[model samples]
Target: MLGAPGPSPAEEPPGGGAASALSGLTTRGRSFLAAGFAAAVCSYVLGQADLLRVGLLLAVLPLVCVAVLRRTRYRVAGSRRLAPARVPAASETRVHLRVDNVSRMPTGLLMLQDRVPYVLGPRPRFVLDRVEPGGRREVSYRVRSDLRGRYPLGPLQLRLTDPFGMCELTRAFSSHDTLTVVPRVEPLPPVRLSGEATGYGEGRQRSPAHAGDDDVIPRGYRHGDDLRRIHWRSTARYGELMVRREEQPQKALCTVLLDTRRSAYRGAGPDSAFEWAVSAAASVSAHMLERGFQVRLLTDTGSSVPGPDGGGGLSGGGFDGAASLDTAGLLLDTLAVVDHSAEPGLSRAYDVLRGGQEGLLVGVFGELDAEQTGVVARMRHRSGAAVAFVLDPAAWSREGPADAGESEGGLRLLRENGWTVVPVAAGASLPELWRAAGDHRAAAGAPRGGAAAGHDHERA
Candidate 1:
């Protein structure tokens, strides 16, 4: 998000009056004024004209500087630009600030500071000696965050001080810029994803000449119908113009589901099991999109990315050609700020999966109870191929590893349902697990279930 225009430095003070001007006096300036007053009192008691003159000069100088600074109309504008506005966690991004002195008068020493979140690092500060009339100055700083989220930078604070350092006034611009720190995406080796290429264009043949009359599907002729496509036999029988319906190619679909229930995972911070799942979801989404598969990022609540139909699902309309990159970006951006949901179960995810067409399902989940396991078992029926990365409770549990027997039982149930299951432990290698999934699919062959149970001991 970009910042909006704000009040100018000179006009920022309330009513631009004397009270505001007096409040700008620095401690040193106030001290001088006090000393000057005391000296004037002593000089009057002793009737010394030289002492009186010196006291008067000391008292008036600071006041004079304040009055001059207050009357000086300063017109300046500030703009902040972020390079690579969206960055991966623990990565650095540069922020460029441009300050334009639009006023006719030369500005005095200026101190600039930009506000930033503590996680991103300390506030950036810069000092400029002066900006000649109608001059501009640019400065930049770098910020990095280990955590992922959106952070606001700005309301750029400017401190204006007199040349003599007698007074200092602080003003802040109203505009603010936003920086999105997204989850880190790991590069995965290209392994054949099972069932991802099962759609019409990839696996099925489209032929019109080989089809009999019954196999030829036709629709009413429209204004732009090609004359060559007219089916004379269907037209003659129906007594109306009919055109052969073209077989539209369908892109393979991939849905990346992330378990975000607060009770599902253990630990906290960047190393938490939940964070790991988020990163894995982002990686898989990008990988599938690059492979030209129509991808959807679904959370425990609902779809994370909206489709072309303005619904909460990915449409098949723009998954091909140049729109793939844009889709990948939108998916990553959504995952960057995804948070844990309070929902206690995976029912919502189940419904979303049930409503969509069967394709490839990739899930990153935490510990699952019997009810949750049952729900997931039902979900497998809706996908051509399903793979699940279930986090090991023992790896992230604060009390220690969970019961191994319970974990094994859940994995067995998913395997029985034809799902390729991979157990994720602390510090697990995502790419390695990804490759293992492909290996499991190849070993399983025609049927994708039961065979994966032999690999249950394998952990990544």
Candidate 2:
């Protein structure tokens, strides 16, 4: 996975600008003209013919070299990388650049006109004084981003010129570096959640039904276990019976799935309901990642990827894409590039995930389909999977009729059927939504969190 993303300074489309800066250099040229005119005027005013001729030669000679030097002299190249691809809100990141001189002639006065992504605004630009022939240098810049999202670093344009400003060359460089900023995760205070979802997981062997789920490791045997868990061959060899006990279900592997079927937008207003759905997914995933859960993301509006294991979990460690601060960035980056599918529903993906309910899954969708609802119902009956919905009230605004698109009622329907419903208002923060969902469980005497719980409650 660490095969450095894209080309470095050594590779990429060779700098292809044909004197764009020189051709459009009205100001710099004007300065040159003004200086020459002053020299000529001064020479004439002082009756010095020699001085006038020298100024004319000085200005015109460099002007001619400008066009020619742009196509030759030194071969300049550049590239950039954002180390620790993922960053926290209100944090800092390093942007690295690799500059190389591909030609024999040493390159000097390299002015880089990098087209940085609008997000990382270039208040202060990049400047490379000199790069020796056959030598390369890596330069770094720091950016402080306040917003959370995935941003493209860019196709940087290397603008080079000689000391006299006579000859100039322009080349474009590309970097696969992308910055992903994730929302701050506030840890849940000591609390507990009610129901089998939270407490039932403690000290229990892998449930027979969930044994097939991926990521569930098997521990060695113990006495008084079911006959099915006994290892017969080992008993014959070692003269002692051994059985396999299921390891405790890991708290890391959490997946968030968002519903993006177009039909869910029936009654929305200014902001499309789809955007709210994405926010919900981002919020929940960010929260879980902060809590040390191995987090993965899935959204119907964009591409759906099951986040990798151990990498993004709340275990407090580095991630090689699977579990890292950039995990959220990659998720949102994929989200940014992915468009909503026109498919009728999410039945197929839900069906596939039903039997493999290994990690925690949070499904968010704007509208509810029968097939999707049915799958959720089944997963609940068998695996005790936690289900939460981010339903939009706007779907009823311009819906077929005022009563036709009511969301609260549909949300209620899911709750009645035993699915957890988090009534998320539009424009709400993801952490806020989780708090709301958690508050309800607390009110009903459900285990809200684990900071404070009894011996049995500590399992949460």
Candidate 3:
């Protein structure tokens, strides 16, 4: 049951409105008083005892409920918990709420509700019959959305209603939390690429020679130095404890380029082609990170996934260089709040890749025109291995022809320039579609083309 507004000491006036508007008497509360006054006047003038008694009862009934409610001071507390703190777009997440009544006296019928982001769904509400002093109650609800973003979960609203339904009071709690809805990512099929890490690490072949004249010199052993790295020859020569310092391995980096320019994609909202491109980028990042590749995520407008602490982002074309599984969550968290920019093209990404060291380049893009296709072709030459997944905006538009051939033209151009191009459709199975990409670079031979080439001309 909803209630009349009441003062909220715990909250500010919503939208900077005046405080008086926050609380007011209900229509029912006013009507009961008006009826009582009229009846009392008539009974007194007509000298009718029964009518007088009825008038008194009507006047006093609401007062009694109001007085009881006013004497009961309800001090309530609440905490909200979002399960699976991180989730993918269009997936279900559960919210758990635990409320405690810390008042000295028991609470009357209390109504509870929580505010949420519009995209996540409607505000959830519940009725608590009563809670004894120092007692608690728990409630849970589910939220599902097709949008990817970080949203705040609450500031719980509580209401107190009289048993007679004549009086009502409402209050709002000021506690809030965040929910991160990241882009949906799926597992991709196994694929092979050709590249050698240039940074540092002992690869399949061993090199006994030191890197350079400035290589790390043996010194006194440190607390954390491994005993296995102790150089007995250096220790004997120096007449003290000495250990050889190992060099960090140079791992090959895989750069995931996401096209977030507003002009590059078609449609809008959950089913937009831009959203598909983001999901593809997220999946590819996860796949590469799992394979122990240092990953870098980049977008058109220089936006990147900031670390959890909001520092140390993949800015300035530097790969994160951490190949652990834990690094995937950090990348996904950044993608959750990514929004499209007004930039016209992918020129920024192209420029950054052109000057960076050669490794692997993975491009998740939208429909490409002639000029954009050339930009991609030029960028492909700077990398040891290049793969591009292009989203066909025409396939996703209801008014456009599904068999539009621009995507095929773009794909052919990319293929001719040594880039393995894969065309993607909306709602297509990512695993099956990725597995159909037939381009592979041999260990010794040139980039070879495989036979999974039907979508080049056929409508998605």
Candidate 4:
């Protein structure tokens, strides 16, 4: 069924609706033939030979016309396109159909069979009214997408037949049309992403490794000021352009560390622990980009989702697929390909990235060993990157302390080092979590509140 189907359509119409058409035709054709034959019989019985001959010739003319038309071997043609152009999940889109009759003779009936993509269309069959020769017609139909990803439309088919129902012929059209249906994505309103690492652009300002603060903009070098950045030409022109000293904008970077270990992904419905990590990453990236920071993507899964075709992504900022690709699609694709295992590949990737240039590092994960905790703690204290672990309560089968499987100890270690820590959970709102984390990172350098830290914290 995925490829072309065999069989030139049935000589007779082939569908549930075909039965009615057959019945209607049988009754009408039989009536016409019987009336014509009765008139001929009357003329012959009355011994009017010439009149009877003329009647016979007139009666059989239409049957000969149908035979001739069928032998000529003409074809039917049509085109199809999906509209609104790009279709997203849960949204309705239309399909445009334009049909044309390419034969010299008119077609009274057309049994069209259009191939729809997976799960669309009322049925596989289409019923087209009479089409005039060399004439065109267009029509539209609506369809809804229940899932995400790409869909291809193709192969228009038309079955043509002549009037009087004496003979039938089938004509199939050849053309390919395709459309991609993306996943439904919610809008991002706030700038902060929870359960993500904070680099130079949290509430507090940070300087780049390669460059220090512009330090101060001259309000206008007073006679008593240091002559380090004096603009003599400006003083000669406006008496003083008054170069205002402002805090230099720090170059910032952020990376999302996701937890794809089987042990970490456990969560109840609407509480997928993995989802918390993705949403947190999206929120953080959006927020950081708005604040003029260079953002990078990192994941904690054994093998992170690679950029399309193993190609590295563009640097610094500007929405990648984040704008064109729905957030759900982004996360779902990540989840679909995530390898559920504990691979130290994450640590190696981190080291390679850090070796290039020292910047803030945000760590996202579910389980951390003593050594892993120390590494994250050292990264925050020594390199200025904080790690936030999205904990899920549903991970452990046993019930003990409410904080039994929590990452409180590791969080505390990062906090003491002046690195901000943000925890998230399903019970809280993403916006509220962001505000709380933003406030805490601003006021206390860490938010004590939780947003999506629970292991199984699932739901969108």
Candidate 5:
């Protein structure tokens, strides 16, 4: 989403003077003025014509330049464009600026500066010699940021000066635009969910004896029912038009539960273990959405992440004037701004998911306590298949590794109860983590096993 540009450099208090409204003389101009005034005053006191002439000349030059600058007209328009408007984190993006002289007169050398996020790169500056009426000048620069978020790109600043360089004028174009940096989505090799192996699929199921709910389960074919979804075998047996309902099944649905509790994660800023959790969640959500599963991203607070239109939920809003919501983009956008919650968010997440069962439950979490571990264990039991990417806060500690036994015990609990758990450390390879999760799918269905079936318990 785009936000308004902040107050420009030229903006000042209402009753400000001309000096405050515009740039004053350069150092050289001030130096000349001081020397001229000293010489002029000395010449008058000593009655020396040579010193008087020199002082007058020096002083007059700057005044002439200022007078000329006062009459100079500045009528120009500028526009900025960002190439590949959307990009993965840490990738380079191109920013181009075009300035056109719209006035009748030609302008002299002008300075252009474009402000960008500090993480993207240094602020870009350029020089244009001249631009005649209807003339255009173009400037281009590249920016890349390691973090994912929506950043404003423009509100170009232009510095105009007269030929003598005595007086300067600064104008700011308040036009603003945004650059969206989405999280990196790593592709996982084909992995079969445990429920898929257990024969839970999209095949027809026996309808309830009462009737089918129109908003949810499918019922017998009515007059306007589409024939394509008709279940011929059920129709033959019941001697009625048995149409397959389009209700979402536990097997066809996947929920990405993200732990965003501030108290649970360690370290700080974008490089913390919390960020790694966000990246992992984004990658898994994207992969599942691309695989055609009905995926939803839920925070530990039990609230769905805001979608493209700034609304919550998968079916709530669309972005970029899209006719339908783009699930992958929405998930990434939500992850871009996710912050740690003050309270224990996992409890609320468990409360939300407790009423309904899920197909595949993939959780990206930080260190959990005993009560939180029990909640996750209950969730695992309700889901057909469950996978957990657990971040070890001890790995983020600089005071050497703290006691990991508690965290280990939590992971042990999840694994003992048929949860595929992968311990994640800071800066761990996401593809490897995904592979580990895939390798342990068998363990998710195993009645009793170690933390993972075949994979070793490698931290990070």
Candidate 6:
């Protein structure tokens, strides 16, 4: 069989070597030994030499097989590879395993089994015939999970059996590999994020300090400095050949905050409000990053992506030189294993946001009490454009009807604080909600900026 059933727990050997080989005897081998002993006893009682000789041969054959198999030195190695090691939740990823036999002698029957988490699926097993010296055999299987998290796949177990099926030994490779099942990232529609235009957008205005004829900042001239670029005023002020510095446009900044306090959300499994918030955070982060925005992800505990300055929050140049795909992968990988916090409130996230300059803030929140509401409301002032997606407690859980009033009250408080609020319920369409947020910003007379129009024209 190509993919044989795994060994039963009772059939597994406890250890390797001669003792284990003897303990690994098959039913046939044990029956032969038992029958041989009985025959020998009957022959001795009847004084029959011929019967004794046949019994001895039968008994010794199984012993010889065990001794030979135990003495056989088989050097084998195993390696595992996960194609697309990082995958979105509810998606399949293939895992390939290779077994190499380095011993000079041809190997016996090989049974290969890989350990896998129950959530991902059952462990996969395969059977292969003899492999010649320096030969390798490869096998692959698919695994998937509905929930998002990190799972390990590895420590391949190989069962080597004697040609006669008289004995077997199990050996396991020590190395392991990890598979990251990230949250499903939904593609969001373009919407104007209300924020000060400090990036390379149509609405962006040069700083007043750099507006006039002396817009350039002068620096000490370097060896390759162009003489025409030298600033006369700076040269006259004790500066040796000061040349004007070339300035580069800055990228827009976006902060995505996710509420992870266990008490803030309801239900469980993949459909929980908490999970929805996580997915939303991932989608928003990816969307902003694709638009050439320096995006930072914050949770109730703290910042997930460290800034250029090595702090918990992102600095202006945090994402310098990073490709959008790489940053998106980093963000998604972080969000993949994010779980609810036992501690209450969003104080850590608030502190992280406070440390940064005014920018665009997108928050995905669950049920918030008056204290948490006030905390989040105060955060709006730090961002030029602030948008929040609040989950309806009642929709998240049938037992959470009492929290409906709290959710309504929080939304009202946020809207009064000049935040564009979108109420999210179970099964709500995120794309539609995103468009509604854009409409709300438009109705509020927020300027038409680059983020709202998409980055197509800007890229061109």
Best by TM-score: 1
Q: Can you tell me which runs of candidate 1 are displaced by over 4 Å?
A: 1-16, 198-227, 238-241, 307-322, 446-460
Please provide, for model 1 over 1-460, each residue's C-alpha lDDT reduced to its tens digit, 9 standing for 90 to 100: 1112454332264665688778889988898888889889989999998888888888988899898876777777888999989999999999999988887888998898999999998999999879998788999999999899999997788788899988887777877789999999999887765676543222221112221222346878989879998989999989999988776545567778899998898778988898899999998887776675777778888654656211233333334444666676687778888998998999998998887777788999988998999999999998888899999655775567778888789999999998999999888999999999988877777453454655664642
Where's the lowest-lDDT run of ten residues in candidate 6? 1-10
Residues 350-406, candidate 2, lDDT per residue (tens digit)?
A: 654554445555677666655555555554443234558656545434343224445
RMSD of 3: 8.0
| Model 3 lDDT-worst window of ten | 308-317
Would you list the clashing residue pairs of candidate 1?
394-401
Query: Between the candidate structures 2 and 3, which one is better when assessed by TM-score?
Result: 3
How high a TM-score does candidate 3 get?
0.78
The reply for model 4, stretches above 4 Å from the true place, is 1-79, 84-89, 100-108, 111-125, 155-185, 188-252, 260-263, 266-293, 301-345, 356-407, 410-419, 446-460
TM-score list, all predictions: 0.87, 0.60, 0.78, 0.53, 0.77, 0.86
Off by over 4 Å in 5: 1-17, 21-23, 48-54, 196-251, 269-271, 306-325, 398-405, 425-427, 443-460
**Considering lDDT, where higher is better, how would the candidates rank from best to worst?**
1, 6, 5, 3, 2, 4
lDDT of 4 by residue, 257-318 (tens): 56555655555322355555544555554455554444545554323323421113322333
* 397: Cα error in model 2, Å: 9.7
| Candidate 6 lDDT over residue span 199-251, tens digit each | 33233311222222333468788897789988889899965788886655455
| Model 3, span 184-292: residue lDDT tens | 9998866655552432221321122222322468878889879998899999999999988677434446678898877777788877788778888889888766665
lDDT of 4 at 100: 67
For model 4 the TM-score comes to 0.53
Worst 10 residues of 4 by lDDT: 1-10
Candidate closer to the true structure by TM-score (higher is better), 5 or 6: 6
